[model samples]
Target chain A: MKSILIAMLVAMTLPFGLATPACAGSGDVVVENAWSRASIGTSRPGAAYMDIRNAGDEDVTLTGLRTDLAGMPEFHLTSTNNQGVSSMSPVGEIAIAPGETVALAPGGMHAMLMQLRRPMEEGGTFPLTLLFSDGGEVTVEVPIRGIAARGPDD
Target chain B: MRRRSVLGYGAAAFGVIGMTLFAGWWRVDGPGAPQAVGARPLPLTEMEFSLTNHEDRTVGPETLIGSPTIAFFGFTYCPDVCPTTLADISDWLDALEGDAEKLNVVFITVDPERDTVEAMAEYVDYFHPAIRGWTGTERQIARAVEGFRATYEKVPTESGGYTMNHTASVFLFDAQGRFVSTIDYHEPREFAVPKIRRAMNDEEAEGA
Candidate 1:
């Protein structure tokens, strides 16, 4: 019986030791509905939005992001005064609590992509890497929708 | 007792500042100068101004007044707001059925520096063929915005280029060139469609 218990413990610990970084597919931190709009005549600058959810028991901080789609990928926020004047600014870091969802939406929080290598053509797809402060890196495929799409669901 | 007096003065000062900020906010939101909805007609001043259209022809209130006009002030470079609003307008017009013909939709560019007539033409064409676009010199654009009582300012970015900070509301005008109502930016289609129908119907009533 003592040997059997030891074997069971070894089996439980083996999965953890061999586990890989949560790649947004393992569901530790999941990114859903990642989407950006199509470019018009010029590629210029573009914006993307998505929902980042933390399903694990521990909190996670989004420390970095990368994409070949743009020269610069920045987390940004759009703020409007009561007078309807709108402004955009870069956000330093975004933290997601355990079991909570953070939405990056238009007219609010978004990912600003600058100096695109090519136009984000409609119906195209691109890859994004989201790095967590806990050293977990997730690669997600983002879809390119219409120029006036409100979101991926649209 | 001295500490209590200081606290009292601080509270009073804070209240004064709060009220001033609230007033400013109200002014910007209530562009037509706050009036009870559906109770009284807006005392709209004459909607008169001249700007070059996409075709490089001069147009003004005289040309747009014959039909109900839906005008939005935005730039072509706007990634989200402008295109989203234009799409919403297109959908609203579609929901209008045949009544869409009685309405003329216009987009006036606030960033006159980059939004030339040629650019405006291409931009509007991508949205809807019926939607005309307008752009002009800085002075002309400024005068047009002033006439509409709208506001816009240029904000410089780190890259040395600039973005426009402007009113996001869509202004509705009756066929007689009277101010009807302002549609809040990104208002749901159900809410906006009705307001537009009412604006168009009101024109028919006046004409009859």
Candidate 2:
């Protein structure tokens, strides 16, 4: 009976310990609907939007983002004035709670891909890496979409 | 002794006259009244076409030619740059005080897929009620953009999504539907306001 109780305790604690590393590892950051607009040969800028989900036990903050396709990647928010004029402002940090999701979408918050290195071809894939506040980073593949294509919700 | 006193008084008067002339010249030709740079002269490149306004009414290039029009190309879905630029134009108009009547601001939607006549009407009205919004079929919009040599493209994304990328320059046209000058996106206020005033003044001078 003593042996059986010890074996059961080990099994329970082993699973918890194994799960912790997996949760702490890279797969915890899930990006859905990541995409960028197509650009002409000019130095036109583009934007990318996606939903970021954190399925971990602790909170995480997105601190940095990068894409080789552009000169710089900036997180931004858009606000309208009383005259109904809209403007874009930089975002310093984006916090996500455990088991929650944060969305970067049009007409609100978005990621600006400034100074395109090359034309963003349609149906092509671009690489992006998002750095977290906890020193964790996740790299994802974003596919280019047409100019008039609507978002999933749109 | 009397001669010396008269000469001293004359010397003082000469000094005062010299100082007044110097001050007058400084006020007229100094940095304070420096010649304006980027002042676009009138009678820019002109083109004529008929298109539908936000009200779905037919508006021809003639409508743009009779007034000093501040034209911008953007889409309704543009959450930032479009609105910001439009707002800046509105602020400039307000700053003009009573001179707003001399200006006609027009927003041309580059995203024709979503910015319909009704949509443009609502979107442009949200800015300044006096501002005009213009949109037409994709072909018409393409023709208009091509005439201005503006560039735009649609890119595909994951999950069947896309975004419109286009040139960000603001085009200014005189009352003759002529292309006056192009303002860069990051133009400073000190430069922009003076350029606009010069354009308006040029129009008045031409009319006179």
Candidate 3:
């Protein structure tokens, strides 16, 4: 009887451990080097960056992002005028190829955290949720980094 | 007996309430009422020079001498920094309420090739009617920028085009053309606005 009870307990815990597979639809989408910029106290906006790798066999499109620290979240791209000027524009979608990765960094494509509710202190972490086009969401903890920190592509 | 008693009570209550309200209202509307007004004032700086306005007119720097000036530098082709900074400035100016008139905002373009006097006028107009755009010959603008130690340089790209890498500080100058301070392009309003107001008030106190 003792051995049977132990076996039943193990069986019950096994499903609990494996239950995570249901929420992570296409397996784990790894978010590496995720970071957000420190907010300036004024009408200042900050940018967040990271590398997204879709190790699964299916392509993934990043549809949206949400953060409590910002009034709104947007994906953006920074372009330099070959004529000697640099500018940034809004990027609508970022597609991640199967078994490939997309990077967001400074002076390139990045996530804009607008209307910051508080200043991002260095070494601090904040919660952000990234929604994939296929209705899957991944929550990440982003580290606050200095302005000089280079992104993956940089 | 009951009717007479009720009528007497009603008349007594009405007279007492009316008298109390009349006294309170009279006191509030009387000449001795308290008045609240803003006591803090921004300071003014003055400077004089003959520079060209975006209208191609030779307007002296003296035109900016009477009011506080917010100045920024960038070229016309700049995709992000210039417009973002200018838009922020416009928002800041709009928030100033009655304090807006005491300010003279200037957008000075570093790319003289594209930002002509007419072009600057049109561009600055897009942000705020109160903002003035200033552009001049390369040599003239170079001299002006030199006076403030602001710097910019051009680098060639693979497409045979060039990009300008320039300083991104927005300078606050007093009416006298003296550099009061510098605000980082992305600094929050909590820091920027209060500092600007302080600078203005300091100038006023000194003038007084």
Candidate 4:
């Protein structure tokens, strides 16, 4: 299946501890397993999840996110309080250290795509540009899975 | 002397009534209430809701009288818990196979202002065919929330938009409209499916 291929691709892209660090300050942030769910409608926002691995030797802070799929993309966290009530709120940038992987997965941290340009249909892909504080931008193709999909593997 | 005897009888009568009420509470909302991490007791008494389904049909408490029901409160814009829970519900139904049809799954929207009938139709349709979406006016939604003893509020986000905070547990009811149990958010299928079946197998088994 397509998701399996994506999983394989993510596994292959993982750090193997080979190759020298790039000095030009690009490709330092490797994103893997980037996937999103099919939106209910164009008006309602969609969520994109992925794992960000910092391959560089320096600490990099993810400043912002951008995509044509939505008017604005913000880092949102969905948290459940002790009262069994759930709330989603916007969060700040994420920082990744060298050789560290930060996951923006379901039921936790995610990129909330707001005011979609169009519906994110299943079997589709969108380009998401992750802006880093180091003036580097990494764009990854996010595959669209089913509405109820748990993750890229699912 | 007469006052002392009258007082004794009054205390004994109150004690009997208290035990009766507690026994009823213990039967309905006692055990299952604690199993859920943050669950509130599904109202001690019967709760009801009258709303319009995604199919544009009016569904009320009476309409679900003969079947076991699962009612969940959430919104369409909720990307995390709502979708995750709905997916679990879909999987639970799949696990149930034939028995799934015996259950009535209803997803009621807390944010009716944005969740229109058309919106709910598409939302629930994406999860499962049997899952029904319901939406009503603000007043109607408030009544439903109050009746079910659930809570929800619209919180303003930094983007000048609003998101909803709502009860995340799924409520199960017997065919007689009595509260049976609650399934927490992200509850494993091993536990959730049995709760659904338990509700389904209660008094007046479905498909009779």
Task: Provide a comma-separated list of chain B TM-scores, one per candidate.
Answer: 0.78, 0.74, 0.72, 0.77
| Model 4 per-residue lDDT tens digits across residues B118-162 | 989878888878899999989888888777767899999767888
Query: Candidate 2 on B13-38: residue-level lDDT in tens?
Result: 99999999888788776655544322
lDDT of each: 0.76, 0.67, 0.65, 0.82
What does candidate 1's lDDT look like per residue over A1-154, in tens digits?
A: 4533653454345345433555332236667668888886444578888878776666778876798988777787777666555667778878898778888877777877777778888999888888777677777788988876766865
Ranking by lDDT: 4, 1, 2, 3
**Distance from true location, Cα of B146 in model 2, Å:** 1.6
Query: Candidate 4: how many backbone clashes?
Result: 0
Cα lDDT, model 2, residue B169? 63
Model 1 regions more than 4 Å off = A1-27, A41-43, B1-45
Candidate 3 at A62: error in angstroms?
12
lDDT of 4 at A32: 79
Query: In candidate 2, which residue ranges exceed 4 Å CA deviation?
Result: A1-154, B1-45
Candidate 4 residue-wise lDDT, A77-125, digit = tens:
8887766788888888788888798999877899999999999999989
What TM-score fits each model? 0.79, 0.50, 0.49, 0.79
Off by over 4 Å in 3: A1-154, B1-50
Per-residue lDDT tens digits for candidate 3, residues B85-104, read 66667767767767867888
Error of 3 at B88 (Å): 0.9
Q: How do all the candidates rank in terms of DockQ, highest first?
A: 4, 1, 2, 3
